[model samples]
Target chain A: MAEMYSTPHEILYYEADVTGKLSLPMIFNLVVLSSTKQSVDLGVGPKFTHENGVGWIILQEDMKINRRPVDGEQVILQTMAKEFNPFFAKRLYRILDQAGNVLVDVDAFYTMVDMEKRKVARIPQAMVDAYQADQVKRIPRLAEPTKFEEGMEADQVQEYAVRFSDIDSNQHVNNSKYPDWMQDVLGADFITSHEPTAVNIKYEQEVRLGEYVRSEVKIVGNTTLHQIWANGTLSAEAEITWTEL
Target chain B: MAEMYSTPHEILYYEADVTGKLSLPMIFNLVVLSSTKQSVDLGVGPKFTHENGVGWIILQEDMKINRRPVDGEQVILQTMAKEFNPFFAKRLYRILDQAGNVLVDVDAFYTMVDMEKRKVARIPQAMVDAYQADQVKRIPRLAEPTKFEEGMEADQVQEYAVRFSDIDSNQHVNNSKYPDWMQDVLGADFITSHEPTAVNIKYEQEVRLGEYVRSEVKIVGNTTLHQIWANGTLSAEAEITWTEL
Candidate 1:
């Protein structure tokens, strides 16, 4: 069994939307931060990657929100490694209120990549051991994100020039920014009337600074499919389901 | 003397730049959050404004960074109301490391506004009393931001559509996003080699959702001047001085 790590966070005003509940992007940010903190403590984080010239890149992620924490609410963010192989790893995350009620659950898949070669690489044994990733656990699989068909026309399309603020320490667009771009495509009216219940995303390419990316969204019923294209290349895709608030 | 509030923050990986040091926009976010927290505790926050139909709006702000905290560092964010008049209020903010070393200092000026009228309003006596603003105290003044000439051409200009993610509970673009937009105009090379030492900015108009704003930058030695225009109307202006790191 892998060790679980937990961190406490108070939802700041900036983290909430007009509805006074935590925004989807801010929720994703909290989960990512918590996971990074745990990885750093477990000795499989940036330090290890820098020394080995290999790094972990997230392949897919999906999250379900049971209840959203509001401004000034303190919640515990917890994460644990569920499974790992030479090529891929799976992790689990949960956010809980003080009363122990679960607020959100997330499942994420990651793979090792050679920084210099720009290709998938085998995970080093030491890295796997550090995270106790050999343990097998029964983790429920999240819904798979839909891939938009090539040449499919989108109902809404918006272009964004990747700004410096979007880039993180890795010199690439942070994964959390992808969800923000997708949510923006929904516009203010749709977002205000509905709240996200589930989100699934898959990363295909890296978005770099000073580059322009086009976001396309196709809505059908309660689910929305999104695709992000940098230049002419598909960078990422996602599926989100919303429920009326 | 008004009470000072302090909150501890662990610098998240997403808040830092490629150098692993805190980014300018993140630093501003921390200060703003701290100030908001303090105001809420003092009974002059959003809740109070909602009840009174009057709210505070930032007029100008300036920050000086002495050191930048890196990822995994735990720092203390502190703020206090320094001075207040019938028409304006001044607040002070400081960021200190665990060892009590000051990392950043900021001064911000704000004025009350009528939410319904969309115009500046007098600070109500009851609201001022709630914050204990009668006590006069001397506070250092920050450098005033320079205003650009109407006919001056910008060296570089970029347009950005205000996305839903950029809007706050007030249904307008958050003030912090303005600095992010201005910083993006500097490009990667300049940002990589230089660190911001001082920043001064003035807000003139509110930017609403679905609007397009143009960011313009002018460089002179170590200082850069910035202006944001919404449909040919000046919305905000700023000046930032950078030191080679």
Candidate 2:
């Protein structure tokens, strides 16, 4: 079995943000893309795409950031399976700096879906075999959700529209982008102190081309919960927490 | 005259970077898009796009960042004609925070090209007339080409392929991405400290879809000068100076 699956990524200019720091949303994006590449290398290649008309639907994700990284830092993104079931697969990610410092840790849960039907499908057998063969070390799932209640007041709302650029390879709003929606309502000040420690989302609907969604947030105790509604329907609900760095 | 064309842009999730801060590339992108929108607002509206059968080509850019803004900060992007010649047009931009703080100041030069002839074309009279009528606080051309020195030592050459994602609506590497390539050879550390005080680049070639361009860079004194070459021909070149913040 392979010991670990790792990919080296060069921080592109588009990726380096104005603060000269890598933005969190872009970090999540790179992680998702690198993870997809890892899956392909494991021989579960885009088998579902252009052939079986299948793709992975992100049910939820919880990520924690230790520190912000700067632009042009060559980063090594390492991802591995934490656990798998008939319907859901959980994966964990570690982002390492050049000197092997862990910059961020991410845990996400995804379910396979039939694109044509847009419904959750059983995990393909080939994928299960590939995960078993993947050499990456299996890590434990994150213990709990992120916290955002200390300074953030509850019952705030922010609205966003899906643009042409938001669609990814599968033509749906990329899963990594949802975290951005969460950050939008929280404002920049909140993002400064708290990084996403855990993100748990339930995807009940899909957002397509030219649609708009409203993020309604409520901070309950230590938990900052969000509900994303599209055209008055609950598309997804998320509960996240932020930790002081 | 349409009082100093100001464009309202909705921040997209894809544009949120790793730091959860908006990326420089995306800001640069919005500048270009807003500039064009200003032209469309003035009724110039890309007639040259159909006439010359070639679109605008960014020859050089100089962007100064005073502060970095984060996601969901709705700001106004104001653009105006600073100067133009028969061969090229220069534009200036101001990115304001919601509270009216100047986040960034940018100046750029672009030339129309005749695609079939593969050469720069004369600026259309209609385009020039439209922009000249709507000038706002026109500052003297921000670029001082005389400050740029040529013929320096060379050290390393790095190459990058233009991916599908790299292309913008204009169908070239989004003009903003060129700065990333410029920074790639400079190393992330040097680039972060050395805010671009001034820049001068000349685009001589177009990087087609899926073409790889090699970047050759040399650091001399306080300036790092670099060039992008494609198929053994020079595509663009820039000279940047480190500024004290």
Model 1 is docked with a DockQ of: 0.76
lDDT (Cα, tens digit) per residue for candidate 2, span B132-232:
73433333454543322335556656666554334444445666556656665554346445555545555656676556777777777667677887787
lDDT of 2 by residue, A177-198 (tens): 5666766676545655665555
Q: In model 1, which runs have C-alpha deviations exceeding 4 angstroms?
A: A135-143, B134-142
Sliding window of 10 residues with minimal summed lDDT for model 1 chain A = A133-142
Please give the distance, in angstroms, between residue B107's alpha carbon in candidate 1 and its true position after superposition.
Answer: 1.3
Candidates 1 onward: DockQ, in order:
0.76, 0.03
In terms of TM-score, the best-performing candidate is 1
Q: What value does the lDDT take at residue B124 in candidate 2?
A: 72
iRMSD, per candidate, in listed order: 1.4, 15.1
